[model samples]
Each structure stands twice: as structure tokens, then as C-alpha cells.
Target chain A: MKELWELFSVFFRIGAFTFGGGYAMLPIIQREVVEKRGWASDEEVIDYYAIGQSTPGIIAVNTATFIGYKKKGLIGAIFATLGMISPSLVIITIIASSFMHFKDNQTVQHAFAGIRVAVVALVVNAVVRMWKKSVKDLVGIILFILAFLVIAFTRISPIIIIFVSAATGILLSYRGAVKE
Target chain B: MIYLYLYFEYFKIGLFAIGGGLATIPFLQELIQKYGWVTSQELVDMIAISESTPGPIGVNMATYVGFQTAGIGGAVIATLGLVTPSVIVIVIIAHYFMRFAEEPLVKAGFYGLRPAVTGLIAAAGFEVARVSLFNLQEYLDTRKILDIFDLKAIVLFGILMFVTNKYKKHPIIYLIAAGVVGVIFKFG
Candidate 1:
């Protein structure tokens, strides 16, 4: 119905414009779904973001699905995901056709160089924001630091780390040391 | 035949990638080493291009590899392959996530995820930095060793970081500025 089209277009615009992926997409989701549409409250959006991150998928797609379903159910989820991915699919198709031919073009190369630096800035901003909100207590801070170091210095796969941390959370909850 | 395998492989990646696009790098590296579809150098180049482009890095990389492997159709297959799992999972989760949202165990599980996700994000940051900024080959060659660091880039990074951090400016401003700098440097 009309609602489905709205969901599609809204997510289409978001997917088309969002450049840096999950972290960059976060604020857009917040503004559009939470503030403009009243689809979810601030806390709910945060919760969805956390869940979206932990779940097995692209964060933005997962988030859009969650929000879309929240608003309109199964059909909404389908439309939202389509909207989220369609732009990439189309754009990548075009790029795939042309990029190989222009692989070493100076303007393209220089543009990429600038974009990479900007990506660093984007990721840093995301980390700083999440750090303020996520690292609430000593244990959380410890986990953050330890996990960051383990990831940075070691070659341990992140999937293993996530599993271990989840287990730790369960055990801590069992011991009544932390309130989940 | 190969397209089906590629699809399934990326499906696995899409199914298990918990954090984001960058979290897919190590997984893709494993694929490259095992299958020979891509080389390490190509992976590095893909990362650079993917990050710079206007889409998800994983999708972009998948498309690039697919295009290289089997042309345009291959690119479509790979992109779809990488994205399909997430679409399926999200559809299922949407029906049930709220019912489970309140359970203490679920909360604890996600709480645990926060730190781990942070770790993944941090690792991704380090890897990109290492690839983009620290080119040891330039040092080994000794010619224009100083250019290895790309001083203009570093200064731009520093200024952008300070301005954004201090002023809490919108990210678009920085993106526009970077684009302008790229044009100036390229045409100058």
C-alpha cells in the first residue's frame, strides 16, 4: 500500500546517500526513523543499533529490517531491505562495468585517497561516540580495553572474541555481578 | 557452477559477519588465500576503492571480485550472495526480537556483544590505517622514502580531525572539504 512505498523510498534515499556503511548510517537512521517518522523512540533505536551490530548481517540492513518490521511487519522488512541494498546493487553494476578500464586514472585515484582518509575520521567519530555510551562501568571499560588490544595486537578472529564475551556476560549475570 | 559456489561462500560471510563491512576483511582474506580468486594486493586495492566509493565496502569488494572472475553477471551474483543472508535473518528476527528483548539473558548477551563489537571496529580501524598510511615497501626501496607517509594527507587528516572534534561540525562539511582537496591536488 502507500505505507510500503514510503518505507521503500525512505530507505532508498538512506541507502543511496549513506557512504561509509554501518556507522555512518546510524545517525541517518536515527534522524529519519526516530525523529521524523516517530517509528521508534531514542532508547529503542539505540537498542536496535546494538542488536543490529551483534546480529549476523550488515548493521544498516539489519537495523532497517528491524525498524521496518516494527512499523509494518513482514512486508515492511522486505521492502526496507530491498530499498537498502538496491542502490548498491545498481551502482556496483555500473562501477564494475567501468572501473577496470579506468583503474589507474589519476582523478579517480586521488579521489580514493581523500576518501580513505575521510573514512578514518568517520570510524574514529563512531568509536568515540560509542565509547562514551557503551563503557558504563569498570568491567565494561576493562572489556573494551582488553578486547581492543586483543583485536589490535593479535590475529584472533573476532567471531571467537564475540562468542567469548557473550559467554562472559552470561556467567557474570549468573553470578549476579552485572545486571543485564 | 562457480557462481553458485561464490554465492554460497558470500552467503556464509553475510550470515556470520556480526559487526560491519570491515569485519568481513579477515574472512575475505581467508577466501582469497584458499581459492586464489584474488591476491593480497588486489584485496588491498579493493579495500581502498571500496572505502572511497559510495556503498558498503563488502558489497563493493564482492562485486569487484565477481567482475574480475566472471564479468558483469558474476558481479550481480556476488553482491546478491553477500546480501541475501542478512535479508533473510532480518526478516526472521523482526518477528521475534521484541518478545525476547526483555529477557535478562538476552540483555546480557547483547551487553557482551558491545565490547566485542567495539573490538572488531577497533581492529578494522587499525588494519585500514596500516594499509593506507604505513607503506613499508617505500622504505625498502629508499627512493622518495619520505613520500611514503603522504605528508599532505596526514596534515589534512590532522586538521579535519581537529576541526570536527573541536567544533562538532557535520560530517558533510568534512567530506566536501576532502573532495575539494582531492580535486586541487589532482589538478594542481
Candidate 2:
């Protein structure tokens, strides 16, 4: 029980301080969960990250749940998810109540203007890393290009893209074009 | 009652957003357009705020949208709604992820998902870029152009890219540097 509480506290700190979303959260998770606690290995963290990305929902929440569940079980997942979200909930509430003009301030705007570019770069970093890991063959490469074009240029919904892509995978598997 | 609606709405967002938080963009755009809960400009502003602040952009956006529609209680509902599905699904998978961690079908599915998610993430990147770089007025007539894309942003992006490539450092270093630049250029 004490260990579980510790786990929750650690994750809470991570979720609290982490800005710019999942990619930004990675180093923190590595520090708390892997280096400080020795709860999981680097490989395990990477695996959890991969699974977290493939699954639905926020990557941070998904990652916390995976780690928490690995540590304990059902209860751990609950605690981790709560820990991940608690800061955002509290902070957002505080901002909502007191700071209606928060963004209007010049300092805040400038900071954000800087961060916005960083956000794009971070996203680009993620894409490059995933492309290196995921795209092995020509078919995967072609699908990658097609999906990028469809969403970038067209008004088609992303859900439809996911479905079509998944279906194409299933078909490719059936034809033995790709290996499991 | 309204809270429940907010919960279920974000639950849907949680269940369907395959490529993570950014994938929530198109869905949120649809919701804002369909419901008129918030204005388009507000949504853009929310993105700016969400991206610049802490936490997941989707969660922040959900909270903003909920607040716009229903206030504090709405924020809670929307947040819970967004996260609940992840909690449930991860718990269930955690129960079995070890036993089937190397299963072929599961591996195949994720392998396929890799390229697809890459595509989704790229799409998201481009969409945000479209909003950030290209002004609507600029498209209609070049004469009506605004300084939508700042040179500072480009320089920051280029330098960060160089730093990231040259030496592996924490993201905080880049964020801090950018924050300082923002203060000097925009704040000062």
C-alpha cells in the first residue's frame, strides 16, 4: 500500500511539471519511473511508449496507466490516470476562475509564440523517429505518403483514415504482403 | 445532465482518436463547428494556449470547450470524459499485455498502425502549419497579407533543429531558450 502511494506521488509530479504534452513528458517519466524508482527498464519504457501511441486516448494517460498497471494492477491504473490528470484539472480550474486575461498579456503571448515553433519541431521529431522505426518496406512508405496527403489536403475525417489504413493492413496480411 | 453530455462527448473523443492528442484536432473542429459551443477563433486561441501551457493539448482543449459551454463543472466533466476510456482500456490491456506481448496478430496490427499513425501525425502537423503559416486573406489576395509567419519563429525552429541534431539535450533547454527569446522579442 505504501509503495502504491509512492508510485502515485511520483507520477503526479511528472504529470504536473510536464509541458508540451507526451514527447515532453518522456524524459520525466524516464527519470521518475526508470532512474529514480527502478520500477521498469528502459526497454520496458520504450515498449509502453509504443503501445501508448498505438492505443486510443492521450499518450500521457495511456503511458501512466501502462506503468501503473505494470506496477500493481487495476488499482494502479486508476491511481496513475488520476495522478496524470490531477495537475491539469487543478491548474485549468485555477486559470479558468482567476485569469480570464492570461493570454492577453504580452509576456504570455511571446512565450507561446516561441513555444509554437518548438511544438512543430517536436511533432516533426516524433514523425521522423516513428517513420524510421515503422516504415521498413515500400508498401509502408507508400501508405505513409498517401495518408499524409489525404489528411493534409482533403476534408476527410481522421477516423475514416484510421479505418481504411487498418483495413489495408488486414488485407495486406491476408495476401502475405507483410509479416506479423 | 450537461456534465454527462460533456463526459460522453469526450469519451467518444478518447475512444476514436487513434494517433493520440493531435488526432483530436479534426474532431474538436467538427464539434465546435457543429455545436457552436465556441467560436473558431476561440478554438485557435485554445490551441495556442493549450500548446503553450502544460498537459495534453486534447485535455486542455476539452476543458476549454467544456468551460465555454458549461463553466467549471463542465471542465471536470470534459476532462473525465477524455481520460476515462484510456483508463479503462489500459487497465484491461495491462491485465493481458504481458501474456500476449509478442503475439503475431497483435504485432501485425500495431505494425500496420505505425505507418497510419505517422500519416495522421503528419496531417496534424500540416494542419497546424496551415493555420500558423498561411492566412486566409493572404490566399485570396497577396496584397492583404499579414505577418502571420514570423521570422523569429523560423529562426528558433532552425536553431532548435540544429541543437537537437548536434547534441542530445533535454527539451527543457530548448523550451527555456525559446521562452527567453519570446520575452525579448514579443514581451520587451
List clashing residue pairs in candidate 1.
Answer: none
Question: TM-score for all predictions?
Answer: 0.76, 0.74
TM-score between model 1 and native = 0.76
TM-score of chain A of each: 0.75, 0.69
Q: List the residue pairs that clash in candidate 2.
A: none
Candidate 2, residue B145: Cα displacement in angstroms equals 9.2
- Candidate 2 chain B: minimum summed lDDT over ten consecutive residues — where? B128-137
Compute the DockQ of candidate 1: 0.48
Q: Evaluated with lDDT, which candidate comes out highest?
A: 2
Instruction: State what share of the real interface contacts each candidate retains.
Output: 0.52, 0.58
The DockQ scores of all candidates, in the order shown, are: 0.48, 0.47
RMSD of each: 4.5, 4.9
